[model samples]
Target: MDWAKDGRDWPNNEHSRFVACRPHRWHVQAAGEGPVLLLLHGAGGATQSFRDLLPLLARRFTVVAPDLPGQGFTSLGTRQRCGLAPMAEDIARLCEENGWRPHHIVGHSAGGAIALQLALHWPVKSVVCLNGALGTFEGLAGWLFPVLAKLLAMNPLVPRLFARLSSTEKRVSDLLASTGSQIDPRGVGLYRRLVADRAHVEGTLLMMAQWRVEGLMSRLDRISAPVLFLTAENDRSVPPATSVLAAAKVQDGEIVELPGLGHLAHEEAPERVAEEILAFIDRIETKKPPKVSGGS
Candidate 1:
């Protein structure tokens, strides 16, 4: 589905939404009814991450997954670093494009960061963060990746070199592989080929690094929307400690850690995440009991 490669059509119906949108379009997959469930995939992920769960979730809500600009089939419209402000604005645009105003949101990994930004800055009703990469990394491997990314990110020749030396398919496949073997193979293949522009890849890395310095952590308290943060007990990317810190910050928030799951909590534990999400909605919707005639 390297549409950017030969400008070929994407492989699946889900991928076609992206194809139909074409240049300057962000990839999307939509289903079900009621207030939209705006899904934001991780930096390395495409909309396909929610493929299996969408059908089930769609049974209850109108689920829509948007491949963030620079990820999947979406076009990274600028060569400059794609910061959170621009990213959040595009999310607001996607919502306006689809007429999904005042929607609910669910984001995983880097998407979680975007989701948080949306809730704080946009007209979102509520949000669910799945194994989000909000706080700083803890491990030696985590510290090392950013240090390595810094050297490579600034190299103007690096993007072209990777694009020529390696197939875009090959580079993206490497990203899918990083998530773990549990990810759907077909979905991974589609994601790997969605964006042929290596510059976009470098932009993603730059955006992540910027977050490390900009520090959105302190400002999360300003987000007034109710939040349910889902964490993975075994998540290797963002630690449970990070989610714990976030839960304490958001005024109306709770954290539920999925036991034994990894970074991709929804993929590794879809039903559990879905159930919790539905329950949260239920609680929110049940604010007032059925009307009863009363005389005082």
Candidate 2:
């Protein structure tokens, strides 16, 4: 009943509204009251992924949870490129529309890359990433598997296989179930419902096709925002060390490790994740990072 495409089950989420951006009617779930905190989910997720952690983060800052284009209820454009730039652009638009100025962005996995890109390009005050991949780094063979996943994603054969996934309902459920044992009933259903459409299939595959973020790693130094790199002990999805490396590059970055949590640290360990984000926000509001003048 909750998984229906129609707006029958949405009101229960609270701070609910319908915002039309283009191809789809984006379902927004806004709650709490404070500074802006835009939460971005990974490739295979919707706003539902942030269910457990949103309320906590919302305590210290307002949360704008919008399903990315083609991931949740949002739709893709006529001719779209599903990479970091476009995704970040869309997020910027969302922030602007919701009056979420001077916000902070938190991204996970693909969302993490998008968050980094957003931090570089969008008007955000700060950014924090959890278990994200910088698979675009040059000569980083250790992440060869993820890099190869990005490469193989562009193959013509992939769209065919990915497109067919939506036709069968059981396949979708099984895919989401593979993530964790005691999956959230609501989350499992949402994940299944989201990928059941062909357009969603196209949007997802396009992201896979355009999976190239490492090209912008060098430009990260240009990003002056304070970033927090939070990773789990041993995340199989996005290498934890990859995050550590990126953190070291940021002039004023802080890194925190949550022991024994999985790739989805926000959900696996929401309280700890919330605490770190709250601390990061306090740091940013205090003062700007150190700067070198043009006369140097």
Candidate 3:
């Protein structure tokens, strides 16, 4: 769809901006000013996931949330780059090209994997994953979903058909509710808008088709930056134990479970999520002792 036609209606206009970089034109939104924080929404969702959370985070940091290439309003430059490794490289390149240095990176679901991928190349201070897709698919979904996505992505008419079939209010609501998340009307509305766009749907399917995380499981230990997994107790998507198991492997990895929330914890309770984020950032900063006046 042509998102430009309705750009004014998107949330957080005060801080929203677009930057053109090689392979993609990024739709980025930001607020406040201080250390840079990059917020990445899960696959299929866009910046809307952080609508309520951004204002809170912006209060303490220069929060920058962007629509990933091929998802949301961001234009996908090359379909091949939608995979995990390439997508992460493109994101880092975007930051480098735009001169935005993120000290902290926050990601939800698939975006969480992207954040971890970022730590491999960038000098980020920390990374946070909420209901992250750290584990591989299992059971019926494991065998069925990716196969369906690949078939749909390969078909030229599938995106248009899928968008037409899933664009209604009820369909969008059902999709979000299936995640065990209870979101407000505004959050639902943003999703409704996204589902109607054919390009967004196409991009989502393409990314899903190209996505890979199994390779990262073994390499998680090599990621240098500290990582935090903020899990929602009621999440049906990625089990809470995924974080527990992952934290066990890394040197500075940790997990915090938020009671009564689901996969979309940020959307359901932005205030609480922001509280945890602030505490995490504070702890990271506090660990460093003050330097002497002329030490260097």
Which of the numbered candidates is closest to the native, going by highest TM-score?
3
- The reply for model 3, stretches above 4 Å from the true place, is 137-147, 288-296
Better of 1 and 3 by lDDT: 3
Q: Write the per-residue lDDT of candidate 1 for residues 1-296, one digit (tens) a residue.
A: 25556335343344346532322466677778887888788764666677666677788888878766666566666644356666777777767766876568888887888889888777677888887778665444266447646766677666455445545665555544444424566555555543345755555555655555145677888888888778776666678788788889888777775776667667756777788777766766776331232100
| Model 3 per-residue lDDT tens digits across residues 214-248 | 87878888887888788888787778888888777
**Predictions in order: lDDT:** 0.66, 0.67, 0.82
Cα RMSDs, all models: 6.5, 6.5, 5.5
Better of 1 and 3 by TM-score: 3
Better of 1 and 2 by TM-score: 1
The order by descending TM-score is: 3, 1, 2
Ranking by lDDT: 3, 2, 1
Indicate which candidate wins on lDDT: 3
